[model samples]
Target: MHHSLSTGTPLRVQDMHKRFGQFAALDGVSLDVKGGELVCLLGPSGCGKTTLLRCIAGLERQDGGVIHIGSRDVSRLPPQARDYGILFQSYALFPNLTVEQNVAYGLTGASREEARRRVGEMLELVGLAGSEKKYPGQLSGGQQQRVAMARALAPSPSLLLLDEPMSALDARVREHLCGELRQLQKRLGITTLMVTHNQDEAMLMADRIAVMNHGKVEQYGTAQEIYSAPATPFVAEFVGQGNWLPFERGADGHARVGGLSLRLHGERAAIAHGRIFCRPEAIGVNPTVHEENLFRAQVREITFLGNRCRMSFELNELPGHALLAELAPERMPHLASPDIWVSLPPHSLQVFA
Candidate 1:
C-alpha cells in the first residue's frame, strides 16, 4: 500500500435518490464514513444496498444527492474518473493474463520498475507473494479472490468499494478470507464500504452497519446498536434472528407482552402499535436463579445446534404466539419436558414501531 493511501479521507453521501422507471432504488439515502472506517450496507434483496454502493462508486448515476470524498464532489464523475478501488463478487480476474499482469494492470501510470515493485508488494500484501506467474484458473477460489484484491489495491486508492466480495466462496473459505480482509483493511487504513446481505459477515467486518429497506436507510449504527436497539420493525426482524410478538401500548405508557406489563425503551415506547422483538439468546431457559420478567410456557419444538439448543415455546397466556429461546446443552437436561419457564429481560425486548 502507498503511504498516501494508508491515511484515508472521509466519505459523505447526502440525500441520495435513484429510480428505475416506476420503482425507486434509492430514496433519500444519507451516510457518513470517517477516515479509515469500515461501514457495511446490509439489507435483504431489493433493499438498494448494491445500488447505494454503485452510486458511491459512480457506476450508477443518482437522480438527486451529493457524494463527497473528503472535500471533493465526484458524484457526476464516471467510475474510472474517481480515485477509488472496487472488488466485485465475481473476482473479475483475466483468465489469459497471469496474476502479475492482472495486479500490474492498474499501475499504468507508474513507471515499469515502480509498477513491478507495487505488484510484488500488493501480491505479498494479500498473501499471494510468489504465485504471480500463474493464471487465475490455476489458483484456488480463495487465492483468485486474493489476486482480485491485490489488483484493486495495487493502485492504492483512498476508498475501497466491495460488492458482496465473499458471497461466492464456500463457507469455510469465506470465513477465513473475511478475517484476512478485515486485517488487511486495518493494516492499510483504507476507508471501505462493503455491501452484504449476510448478517454475520456485516457483524464481523464492519465498524458500523447501515441497515436499508425499500431504498431507504432504516438505521445506521454499530452492529451491537443495530442488533440491540433497532430503530424500526424492519430493522429488528432483518438484522438478526429474533421473534416479534404482538404488542400494544398500555394505558400507563408501558408495553403489554402477553400477560406481563413491562416498560419499553427508546422512542418507540410512545408509539401506539408495534411488535416487541427479542432474540432467542436473550430469553433465559429455566434459570438456575430467580430473575425478573419470568414467564411460563410449554415447549413446542427443540433443535440441536452444536453447542447450543434452540427450543420453541408457546406462551401460556398468549395463545397462538410462540417464543424461541436458545440455551446451552447442559441446560437441556431438565428442559427436555414440555413444561418450561422462560424469562425475558426487559432490556432485551425492543419495542419496534
Candidate 2:
C-alpha cells in the first residue's frame, strides 16, 4: 500500500448568505481554511454550522457570495463537481454490501483490479484491513464509522467535509475516535472542515475553531485564543465555564461589584455598567504573593471533582453575590476555615462594556 501523503487544497467562503423563508440560516458567514489544516465549525443546533458545510459541499446553494476550493470558484457547481468527500453523521454505509463494495462505491469508473486495490488500501488506511468481507450490520458503531471514513477517503479528494461524524457513538468511543481521526487527517494532509457542537471535540481536533451563533460566525481563532480572549459575550459564555459579576462604574472612575472596588488589567471602558468576567480556574486561592483583587471569601459549597474541587463562595466585602473558584487537590488543605482569601487576578478579569 502507498503511504504517500497528498497535498491539501485551501478553501475560502466569501460573505456567504442563505435563508429559508423569513429565517436566515447563514447570515453573511465567511471563513478561510488553509491547506492541510482542519478547521471546525462549532456551535449549537440551528447555529448554521451544518448549513455552511452543506453550502461548501454544494448540497445547498447560497443566495449570495462565492465558495472557492483552491482558486476554483465552486459556488455554482454541483456536489459531484466539487471534488470533495463528505462523511455524514449516520455513516451512510450500504447494509446489503460488503465493506469492500461499500468503499469502492465511488470508484465506479475504475477497472476491477484498480477498484480492488483501492478498496484494500482504504480499509488498511482506516485500520480495518481484514474486515473488508463483513457487512455494515456486522460491525460496531465505531467500526461502521471507520468504514464510512474509508469510503470517503477512497476517492482521495483534496477537501474532506465531516458533519458530526462521531455523534452516534458513546462518550468513551467518541473521545478515542476523535484522536484517531485527527491523527489520520494530519497524516493525509487534507484540508478539512468539520461541523460539531462538541466543544471538547473541536478543541481537541481542530487547528482553528469557528464559533457560530445566531447564523453568524461569532469568533474564529485557535482554541486558546478564543478561550483566553473572547471577542464577544456570547463567545465567552458559550465556549467554556465562566463567572460573571455585574458591576457598576463609580463616579471615581473605578468599577465596583456592590461596595467592593475592583481593578482591571486594561484601561477601563467608559461605560456606567458592565460585567466582570473571569474563568473559575483563573481565581487564585491564598496566593503566596499579594494580588490587587484579593478579598476574603466565605465558603458556601464545595464540589469535589477528583483531581480538582470547585468551591462556591461569597465575598465578605460584597455579600449576597456568589462566585466560584476551582482549586487543585494540593490546595484543598488551605480551605480549612469557612473564611479564606481568594484573588481574582486583574489580568484574568475581562471587562466588557
Candidate 3:
C-alpha cells in the first residue's frame, strides 16, 4: 500500500442539492473525502455522479447546500476562484497550444521562469517530458489524457476533480492508465474526487467508492466492503456479481426460499419478504456433507468468462429463480453432473430488507 501525507483538510459536502426544472439531479448529497484520499462517485447513467462533480468544481452551481474544500467555503465561488484542478472526460486540451503551454496555463500568478519549470516537472511526472511540443491533435488518446492530467496537477491545487477522465480510451489503455493514475494520486497526496460510471474503473482506483443512484448516494464504503456486504438492495444488485433471490420469512423464523428453510446469518432483517443475496464465489459446488446450507440444484447454463466459468443453477424446488456460481476453470471436473449439491456459506448470506 502506498502511504499518503496527512493534510488534515478533508473535502466536506453537506446537504447538497441541485435541480434542472422538475428533475432533481442531486438531492441531499453529502460526502467527506479525507485529504490525500481518492474517492470515486460511481453509479449508472443519470445517477448524478457527473452533476455532483460539476457542482464541486463550480461549473454547475448547486441549487442549495455548501461545498467546503478543506476549510474554505467554495460553494458560491466561481470556478476560477476555487483552488481546484479539473480533468474532463474529453481531456480538454488546447489543440492550438503545445503540451507545455497547456500544462502551464493554470499558473496564473507564477513568473515565466517558474511556469516553465513547473510545466517541465509536470510533463516529466506524466511521462511526456519530450513531447512538450506535441499538440493535442498529434498525440494518441492515452497521451492526450496524460497531458490533461499533467495540466490538472501543475498548479498544485488543494483539490482535484476528475469527471470520467479515462472513459474515452480503449479498455487496455484505460486499465493501464488507471493504475498509473492511482499511483500518481498517492504520490502527490492531493485530495481527489472522481466521477465514473465504470464499476471496474472505480474498484481499481478509488480509496473509497460512493455508489450513487437516482440523485442520491446509495452506499459509500471500501471496495471489499461494498462487494462483500452491500448496505442496500440496490447496492447488492449493482456493485458486483451476486445472486439475489426472493426469500420469505418461514414459520420457523428462518428465511424460506426454493421450498427450503435455511438458517439466517447475522441478525434478522426488519422486513419479512425481501432478497437474500450472496456473491457467486461464496457458493460451493458439491461440498462434503459436513457443510451446512446444502441445496439440490441443476446446472441450467454454463458461461465461459475467461479466467472463470459462470455456472447458472436452477433450484429443484424453485425453478423460477437462478443462482449463479463463479467457479475457477479447475473446478470443471468437480461439476460433471448437472444435478450437483451446492452449499451456501453461512457467513456469506446477507438479507436486504
Candidate 4:
C-alpha cells in the first residue's frame, strides 16, 4: 500500500464536440489535465460537464475531436479499452456480491491468489481492511463508496475518472470523503478528472477547476485565480457570491453610479455602460482615511454566521440599491449605529461589459 505506481498520465481533449439531434451537449470543449493533477469539471446542471467526462471515458462517442491519454489516442476506443478506472455517481456496487467480490470485479483474468492480494491492497488503501465479506447493503454510504473506489482502482488505471463520486452522500459525509479521496489520489499520484456541479466540492478537492457552461468550458484555472480574476460574467457569478452595480463612464473617465464617481484599479475598458462586480468580502467596513470609494451606508440587516457576519446595506449615494459585505463577528460591536462608512476598494472591483 505504501509503494508508488507512477501510473499517472497526461490527458488532453481538443475541440471535442457532441450533439444530440439539434441540441449540442458538448460544443467545442477542450481541456488539459497534467500528470498527477486533480482537475474538476464544475458547472450547473445541463452544462455538459458529465457529457465531457463521458466522452473522455469513451462512454459516449464525440461527433468530432481527439482525446489523448498520455501518448495514445483513445477517441475511437471503448470504455474498457481506455486504460482508465471510473467511479460512478451511484456507487454501482452489485447488491448480490460481497465487498471483496465487488473490489475484484475488474480483475478479470488474474489468478485467485493475485486477485485476493490486489483486493486486499485496494481495500486497505481505502481503509476497509477487514470488511471483505460484508455486502454493499450492510455498509454505510461512506463505506460503500470506498468499496466502489477500491473496485475502480483495483486495475491500477493510468487515469481515474470520477463522475460526482460523493453526490449520494449527505453534506457531512460528502465533506469527509472529499478529503479522503483527495489524499488517496495524491498518494497514488494518479491523474484524475472529476465532474461535479457542487462548487464547494470542486474548490475543496481539485488542484485546478474547469468551469463549464452551455456545453463549453468558460474558464480553467486554480481556485484563487477563478475566484479572484474571473474571465467572464458567467464565471464571476457562478463561482462565488458577488454584488453587481450598474455604472456609466463619466467625462472624467471615472465610473459613475448614481451620484458617486469611483476610480477603478485596472485600465478602463471601452464600454460606456457596464456593471461593477465586487465580492461581499471585498467591501471594507469603516476604512481608513486614505481608502477610496468611501460612502455612508445604511445598515439594512445583519446576519451573524458562526465566525463571520453578512451585512446588507444601501449606500446613501446609490439609494435603494442594497449591497452585501462580509466581516468578522468581532467587528460588529464597532458598527452599533444604523449608518456607517464602507469602502469599495478599487482593486477588488471587476468591470463587466
Candidate 5:
C-alpha cells in the first residue's frame, strides 16, 4: 500500500498482503488518497493500520503487494529511497544533535549553506524558530515533537506519514499542536496519512477516515458519514459515541422496540436482530409527538459538560442498554428523570443487519 489513490496518480497499491506465519496482518488492503488530502487510517490496536503505513513507507516488506509512488513501483525500495517523510510517536531526534542539525540529517550531501537555509525554513514553518542550538534533550516534549516535524519536512517529501502523531504530548500541548500540524500540512500541500486510535483526533484532523478492525477496514468514509451512517454495529459504536437500543423486526419496514413500532428505512435481514441508533444530538427531551417515532424513556442521569450536556436514559423496551443524548445549556431543566416520552425521526435511526 499501488493503483494511485490520490488524484492524477500520486500513489497506488494493488492487492497488498502482509503475513507473519499463519497471521495475516494486512489482507489485500487497498486505499487511495487524493493529492493534498489528509487521510487518517483509524482503528483500534492490532488492526493493521500501522502495518499498512509501514508498507507504504517501505520500512516493512510485505509478503505480497505492489507499492507505487508517483508512477514508480518502489515495492523493493528501502525506507530512505522512497522519499517519504515520517514522524513517529517518539521524536527520534538524536540527543547529541542540535535542533538544526537534526532537521538537516537527511540533507548531508547538500552544501552547509543550503542545509542551514532549509532547516531555518522548516523551523519557522513549524513555529520553532530561535531554538536551533538546543538539543532534543533540552527541549520540552512539544518542542521536540515540532523539531521532529521540522526534520520530516525539511526535504519536502511528496508524502508525510505520522504514526500516533500526538501520543507523546500532554493534553494541553496536544490541543494546540493538533491545529498547528493540520495548518502546516495544508500550507505545504503534502499528501499525508496518519494512524490513530483516538476518534476525536481523527475527527478533528482527517479529511476522510478509514476505520479498521481485525486486520480489515470495517468502514471508510468522511467522519460525518461514518458517524451518521455507520455501515455496521462496530463502526456505529466505535467512531465517537452512540447509544443503541435493541429492536425486533416488525411487519413491512418496521422494528418493534419497547412495544412501539419503529419505521425502518427498509426491511432488514431475517438474521437482523436489529438495534436502532440515535446520535446523542438526535435524542430530544419532552417533545410533543404529532406523528410516529415516539417512545417512552426514563432519564437515568444528566451531567453538565460546560458548553454541552450529556443526558443518559433507560428506554422502557431497551432497559439493558443506556442511551446517551446531548443537549444545549438552556435545555438542562428538561433533563429530569422518571418516565419521559421522546420522539426521534425515523431517518435518524440506523439499523445493521
Candidate 6:
C-alpha cells in the first residue's frame, strides 16, 4: 500500500480499497501525483479508473486506506472541504445561462464584476474568450467542453479531476483537443488527474500513467517504462501488441525463443523461463545478414493503414504468442515475399518479472 511521492509530498494514495457489494472496485491501489503533474489513471471500463478518481474527489468512500493531499490526511474529508475541482463527461452547463455565467457559477460569493472578469480570463485560457456571450447550445461540442473545463477551473481548487474529458468528441477532434488540453495544463502548471480508457490518449497526455485492471493498479510508471518493461502480463499485452515468446534465462543473461538466441542487457535472464515481449515496430522486417536473431514467420494477414501496413504473422512452432509487425509502405518490397526473416533485437525484447 506504500506509494511513492516527493519528500513531504503533495498527494498520496495509500493502499486504497473500495467495493460495491461483492464487486471490488479498487484493490490495494497505491499511487502519487506530484505537484503540477498531469497524471492519467488509465484502464479499460470497469477497471476502477473512475472509481479511484471519485475516491480522490471525495465523491466515493473507500473501505480501506488513506488519501493524502500535501501530506495532510484527506481520507475522511468531504468533497467541498477537500477543495478539488472535478469535470465530468458531460459539460453540465445550464442552457439558460450564458457561457460567462456558467464559468462563473461556482464563484458565488464574488462580486458580479469580479466573477465576470474571472470568467473572461478562464474563457481566454480555454480559447473561448469571444464565445462567453453565447449559451452552451450555440457552441460546438469542442466549445462546450472548453466551457466545462473553464467552469471546473474557475474556483482554482488545489487539485483537478477530469473524467474521460475527450471521450465525447469525434476521433479527429479528440486527437486535436487532447493536445490542446495537455498544452493548457502545462501552461497553467496545474496538478491534475485524468481518467481515460484510450491508451493513445493516456500515453500522449500523461506525465506518468497508472494502468488499472480488475480494480487495482497492476502496473504504474512513466509511459516508456510501462511500455518497454511491463511488470505484469496484462500490461505487456495492453500497452501495445507484442509477440511473447517463452524462453529459459541463462546465467549469462541469454535466452532462446523460437530457436533464436538473444543476449540481454543484464546477465540474469537465464534463471528460469519468462515471457519476452517483442514490440511490433521493434521487430525488423526482412533483416539483413548482420542480424543473427531472426525468426521464420508466416504472414496470416496484412492490413493497409494509409502510410503503414499492419501484418499479422505466426511462428511455425511458438506457443502462447503471435507476432504482429508494422511496415512502412516503402519497405513492403521484401515483405511481399512469403516467410520473411524478422530480426528481433535483444534490446527490444523486454523480459518480465
Best candidate, lDDT: 4
Per-residue lDDT of model 4, residues 101-131, tens digit only: 9999999899999999999999999999999
> Best candidate per TM-score, number?
4
List, in order, the clash count of every candidate structure.
0, 0, 0, 0, 8, 4
Model 6 spans with C-alpha error above 4 angstroms: 1-9, 248-265, 316-322
- The Cα error of candidate 5 at residue 223, in Å, is 1.1
Q: Could you give me the TM-score of model 6 versus the true structure?
A: 0.90
Please write out the lDDT profile of model 5 over residues 268-337, one tens digit for every residue.
4233566777788886677754645777888887889999988788768666668788889897766555
Off by over 4 Å in 2: 1-6, 251-253, 269-272
Model 5 clash tally, residue pairs? 8
lDDT by residue (122-154, candidate 2, tens digit) is 888889999979999999999999999999999
Report how far residue 174 has shifted in candidate 6, in Å: 1.0
When superposed on Cα atoms, how far off is each prediction in RMSD? Answer: 2.1, 1.8, 1.8, 1.5, 3.4, 4.2
Q: Candidate 1, which segments miss by more than 4 Å at Cα?
A: 1-6, 251-254, 257-271
* lDDT score, candidate 4: 0.92
Q: How accurate is candidate 1 locally (lDDT)?
A: 0.89
TM per prediction: 0.94, 0.96, 0.96, 0.97, 0.92, 0.90
Report lDDT per candidate: 0.89, 0.90, 0.88, 0.92, 0.82, 0.83
Cα lDDT tens digits for candidate 6, 232-276: 889888888777777776546778665556776564364477777
Model 1 error, position 95 (Å)? 0.6
